[model samples]
Target: MDQPPVPPAPTEQGEPVALSPPLLHAMLEASHCGLVLLDDMARVIYWNPWVVRTSGVALEEARGRRLGEIFPESAGGRLHQAVEESLITGLPAILSPRLNPHPLPLRAYAPDGRGERLFTLMMIKALPVEGGARRTMIQILDISNSVARERQLREQARELRAQAEAIGRLADHDNLTGLANRRLLSELFFKARSRAKRSGRPLAALYLDLDHFKPINDLFGHRIGDLMLVEMAERMKACLRGSDCVARIGGDEFVVLLESLHHEEDAVIGAQKLREAVGAVCRIEGKTLQVGVSIGVALYPRDGEELEMLLRQADAAMYRVKQSGKNGVALTTREEGGWPPFG
Candidate 1:
């Protein structure tokens, strides 16, 4: 058994009175927190039952041993420095878990009940006393549970943020083809128009309607129609520039936005490329399939300023192509790129 610490306390008359060592020993033995007493040389003089249970070192073994000898990992840490400062200056110091976590090799069961080895989070305090051979006392509090809860909350917050981003993407994208929906296309149109105004460049919208699509959809099932639509969207995407955006507005109808255009002729070339991509042969569900597209190109400041007006003019031009023949492209402006009034 180790001896009790008799620290001095001042009476009302300013006289130093020593606390009862036996009673102090009993109290320290029942304490929930770890309590250690060190002599003038910073060697352990008293090791309470709490310290014995937590550190797994018997009182007789801890007696007359330096803290560094008991836990070599704490030799150069803040806990060691605090003990030295308290013994020398008779002042108190605290090592918070935030700055000096796991200064001592204290073990505890993981909060998640996994039976894994977990380093106990500790808040250590070194205080100087005034009596007996014990000059300093070290107190350690277990804060592992609180730290674990804080980490769990941060992890939950990150998961919630990721879920929110995924939801936002779902809202803006078409469910079947994974292309921009009409709502997102409308929103992006305004932003692209803003860029066109700032850069003094032309913007174009290509309204495309697949020719003879309903006959195929009627012959095959809707599943095949859906798969064919996905294939066509992918081919259109592959042919367009990175800055351009393609959207499936509805069944057999799509729209392409040409955002960066140095010349209006780029819109014509892009429309031709899209017609070729849509008109290619594809094998869907082990059956050979082919399709044609009538694309109507509309340019900014020539067709109309608003997206709705541009799409309307492009739709009219596409109707003209359907009347003439399928698998062809048309422009809202005259054939010579001359300005035409909006009807």
Candidate 2:
């Protein structure tokens, strides 16, 4: 076979000789990035081998064609405007990946043919020539790996936020019954008491103890007892308003806070509803089990001013109910020489 002729080397002069067409074409073909040259009319005067390999368009097919004809989606996009601006102003224009990511729908040279090519960052610059003809040079670089890493980081951050929220809930709530624990109940009590004082409304604290809960726990396994406590919490919550607070302070013992109460009678009535709700039969593990709650009511500013004082008074009142009989409500005040029954 005959060998192709090489262009003559320049002498040891000030500037090297201009490259021949074949030499320039060979250099552009060896480039890593996609390179393209467009004339003043935006026609593809030169499309390098890199573009041919990446875009799947041969040089002969791309030559003398407008960019829109090659990539119809790029007709009015940033890539097209960048080329026009560079040619008109004789300056370079950039199409950042953040702003104009994926100007071309070029596919990746994947071995398994599974993945698409990453978005490309492009630059358009004016190419100076001796003939005073306006030409634009376009350069494209792929940035898919960076975008994928950023998305992964965002997903990790979202997971971390969700874990933090769950930790906070666990710290404030009882793990078994999913109700507010002792620590959180104390905080809520003070806040509710302050609001009641400011509004001149009564706040009622009902100290509730599940009657004969230990026998159930001893007869059945602790698992069934745990289920009973969970059911008890749900029924107690159902008997109260949304504004009311319910907390499981300890095993088989819960506290209910009724805020903005109009009268002490309302607290007695609420306690009755709670006792009835809890006394309902529960079928767990194919066995029927029944339970009752002994609730002691204490009104704010009448029973005591401070939370500890009111809690103590309510505890004493609840002891009275337990002494007389279980499954009933008792108020701190004895209006008619006996604690009236609201149930």
Candidate 3:
């Protein structure tokens, strides 16, 4: 909620680290995500407590060993290949290997006794250093559930196009809330901008920042904080039409992209509805938390023609509203500034 809290799944909390190695080790030792650090040569340099828990390996045994040595049963040398390529090519590599590969005729080497079915999908990325070889960070995710769901989804796709939105609920929606995320928002935003340009209708983007969200996380555990986000997404959805796009843009932020609006009032009315809808306090599992939405509105053609331009204006308006107090909307202007935050 406070500027994106770490990476996916859950994490174990510990004390802060400054110039402390013991404290840092303690932190990693406490994390829920299985963390394994590798060197330039793809050798295990550091293995954490979660890794031990998930992998059933001890540090004394794992350290000074290569990944292939430890997981010899894993015929998927895709991780090694990725590392070699990244080292030589100076590029990043991310691969989610298929969980269930077709078994070949030669089955003597079928370790794990599950044929070609992989229990996990390992996501590895090489982070390059300027004067040194890149360090490859590998995160292994259990996707057995996802694999089963995908198979079921493949069969259901033919009849679900009317609401094909059911394809990848976890992929398309925010993890905490069943709301569309930035990935979907980008798709919808571009479509709306295109249609508005062709039909001469005003397109508006509302970038919303949730006020007092971090405080809620601090007061309540992350479990309840996640529930609150889901509740907020539901409330916003109630205020929006099926055609209008509302998406979570990471952390405590959401954007409402209104399309085919002939007048500014249409978008403004939608914004007002969302504002009123999010006004009430939410109670999650005996904890009462209050959060409000700060909206930044930017109109197409009137604001800017480019999608990036419109988004920038909207984002600027959101930050402006945050600066002014909260629970209100602001606009962008050509005379003020433009957003290409990155060159």
TM-score list, all predictions: 0.80, 0.80, 0.49
Clashes of each: 0, 0, 0
Write one digit per residue (lDDT tens) for candidate 3, span 78-113: 667766676566565555636323111112123453
Tens-digit per-residue lDDT, 212-243, candidate 2 = 99999999989999999998999988888988
- Predictions in order: lDDT: 0.82, 0.84, 0.71
Model 1: weakest 10-residue lDDT segment is 115-124
Better of 1 and 2 by TM-score: 1
For candidate 3, the per-residue lDDT at 10 reads: 38
Model 1 lDDT at residue 100: 73
- Candidate 3 runs further than 4 Å off: 1-169, 336-343
In Å, residue 40's CA in model 3 sits off its true spot by: 86
Q: What TM-score does model 2 achieve against the real structure?
A: 0.80
**What's the lDDT for candidate 1?**
0.82
For residue 315, what is the lDDT in candidate 2? 77
In model 1, which regions exceed 4 Å deviation? 1-19, 39-42, 72-101, 109-121, 124-126, 129-136, 333-343
State which candidate has the highest TM-score. Answer: 1
